[model samples]
Target: MDLREKERKTVEILRALKKVNYPGYSRDIVSFGFLKKIEVYDDDRVFIDLEISTQKEEVIEQIKEKVQEEIGKIGWIKGLELSVREREIFRRQKIPIKGKTVAIYSTKGGVGKSSIATQLAYTFSVLGLKSSLLDLDVYGPSIPKMTGTQDSEPTSYDGQHIIPVEKEGVRIMSLGYMAKGDTPVIWRGPLVIKAFRTLIFSTHWPDTDVLVIDLPPGSGDIQLSLAQEVNIDGIVMVTTPQDIALEDVRRGISMYRKLEVPILGIVENMSWFTCDSCGKKHFIFGKGGGELLSKVYNMELLGQIPFDYELLELADRGKIYVLEKKNSEVAQAFLSIAKKIIDLLKISV
Candidate 1:
C-alpha cells in the first residue's frame, strides 16, 4: 500500500477503536498514546512505548491488547512492542476530611449498585457538594457509562498519582477506565484486592462532601479490602423486593455489621413497575421485602424506587434520569432518595 493509503488505513483503524473499546475515559487512552510515542507503520503495524506508573502488570497488558486490536484490522506489519516502567510507591499523607466515603455492596450481582452510587454522586454534586466516585468493580465496571463521561480518562499529576475523572460536577475513577476491551478480567483474589487498594489510596480524590464507592457485589475479597483499608463512613446495601434478594441482603448487612461499618439504610430497586396506560403502580416482584429486611435488621428503609423502564434505559445509555425526564415519577423518586441519603450522611444541604 502507498503511504497515503496506509495513513488512511490507520485513521480507519483508530475510528474502529472508537466503536469497539469500552466507553470509559478515552482521553486517557489518547493522552497515553500521545505521551508514549505511538507510531503507525506503513505496513500497518504500530509501535508503542508506555511508562505507566502503577505496579499492576494487568493494566499494562490491557493497554497493549487494546492498541493492537485498534490497529490489527488493516494489514500485517512487523513490529509491535511496549515497555512499561513500574512506580508503585505512592506517598502517604494525612487523611483529609472534606467529605465522607460511602460504599454500596450487595450479596450478589444485578442489584443496581452502580445506578444508585452514580446517582448519589451526581445528586451530591447538584446540591453544590464536591463529590467523587471510586468504582472498585474491576471485573465489571459501569460507572463511566452511567455518568456519560466515557472517553474521558484521568490524567497523572506529578508523574506519580492519577487525577480523578470529573463529569458534570462529580469526580470519578474506575477499573473500567483502565480496561482495554470486553475481555473478561480473570484476576485472582489477591490481585483484585491489591487493585482495589490502589484505586482507593493512590488516586488524588478532590475535597468533597462524599465519595461513593461502587463496590463489587458480594462480601468478597474486594469488599473486605475496602472495609479494612479505607475508613469508610458507612455502607448502603441495595436489594430488590424479592424473598431471595432479601435473603442476600441479610447476609450483606451481617457482613457490614461484622466489619463494624454503619448501615446507612436500604434502597429497594424495582420495588414496583409503573403502568403506562393507567398511571398506576404494580408490584410485580411481590412486596415488603425491603421493609421486612429493614425491620428485622433494625435499619431504616431509605427509599423504594419503582421499576421504571425509562430509568433503566437512561442508565443503560449513560444519561442521568433527572436530566432526561425530570417530571417522571422515577426522577422524583430518586430526588427524594437523594435527599434522604443526604440526611443520613448528615451532610449540609
Candidate 2:
C-alpha cells in the first residue's frame, strides 16, 4: 500500500481503540484528543503517541495494548511503536484544603464503607485535628444523612464557590443535597465525573489537617477518576469477615495496587458480635478475614469493628458514635483506627 493509504489505515486502527469499563464515554483515543501524534513511515512502521490523563498503569496499558492489537491486525504493519505521556487535567484543579486526603473504598456494596468513612473523619476531628469528609458516593450519598445534615443544603458565598456544611466538627459535602427526597441519581459516567469534579474544586473547605473521602462501592469510574485527579495520601479498605466480601476486597486491593495508591490498612467491619447476657464474643460473620487478607497483602489490620445494634442505630440516626457512645467498644475501635491512620500518614494534628 502507498504511504497515504497506510496512514489512513493507521488512523482507522487508532480510532477503533475504545476504553473498556468506562461507561457513558464512547469516544476512542483518536477522537478523545488523546492521540497526540501518529506517524506512518514508508517502511510500514507506525509510531503513535498518547497523552493520557491518568497515571494508572492498567489504564495506560489497556490503551497501548488495544492500539497495538488493532495495528497488528494489519499484517503488513511490520513495526509498531507506542508512547503514552501522563497529562492529567484534573490535577490542575487545586483543592484549596491544606490537608492530607484519604479515600475509603470497597469492591462490594453494603459493607459499611460510608459508616467507617464518616466515623473515621469524626474521630480525627475528635482528636483535635481539623478534618473534613467528602462523600463521593454520587449515586447513594449517605454522609449528609449520616452526619445529620440531610435536611441542610450547602451555600455559596460568591455564587461560584460552595461552602461545605459542618456537622460535629467535620465539614461535609455530598451529592445527597442535590438530589430530591428518595430520588435516584440517574446520571451517566461522564456526568458523575463532572459532579465529582465540581464537588472537589468548587467547595470551600476550611483549613483541614485530614480530608477523608467516602468513595462509592466498587472499583469503577469514581475510583479511577479520583486516582487520576488528586494525589491521595492513602486509602483504607473496608470489608466484612466473610468469604463473599473478602473476594471483592481482594479485587479492591488489586485495583489500588494497579493505580499505585498506597493502602494504609484494612478495617474489618461487622467482624464479630458480643452477647449482652453472656458477655461472650460470637464469630458472627466467620473470623479473621481482615487479618488474613492484611497478612497476605502485607498491610496492617487497622482494627476490627464488632457488630452492635446500638452502633448501627447511631449510624442510621446520623449520630457520631464516637461522641455519643464514648465508652463503647465500637467507639474505641474507631478511635484506635483513626490514631493508626494519623500515625501511618504522620499528619500533625
Query: To one decimal, what is the Cα RMSD in angstroms of model 1 from the true structure?
Result: 21.3
Candidate with best TM-score: 2
Instruction: Give a tens-digit lDDT track for model 1, residues 1-349.
Output: 5557666755665564444332245455444442333445444455444445556677767766776665565456575544444533324332344777788877878878998888777777766778888888888888888877768888896866778888767788987788746775669778897777778767787566788889878877887766656678878878888885544665566556545568888888889998989978899988887897676566888888888887778887888876667677766777787777778878886
Report how far off residue 338 is in candidate 1 (Å): 2.1
User: lDDT score of model 2?
Assistant: 0.80
Which residues of candidate 2, in runs, are more than 4 Å off? 1-94, 245-247
- Model 2: which ten-residue window has the lowest total lDDT? 15-24
TM-score of each: 0.70, 0.74
Error of 1 at 340 (Å): 2.1
After superposition, which runs of candidate 1 have C-alpha atoms over 4 Å from their true positions? 1-97, 245-247
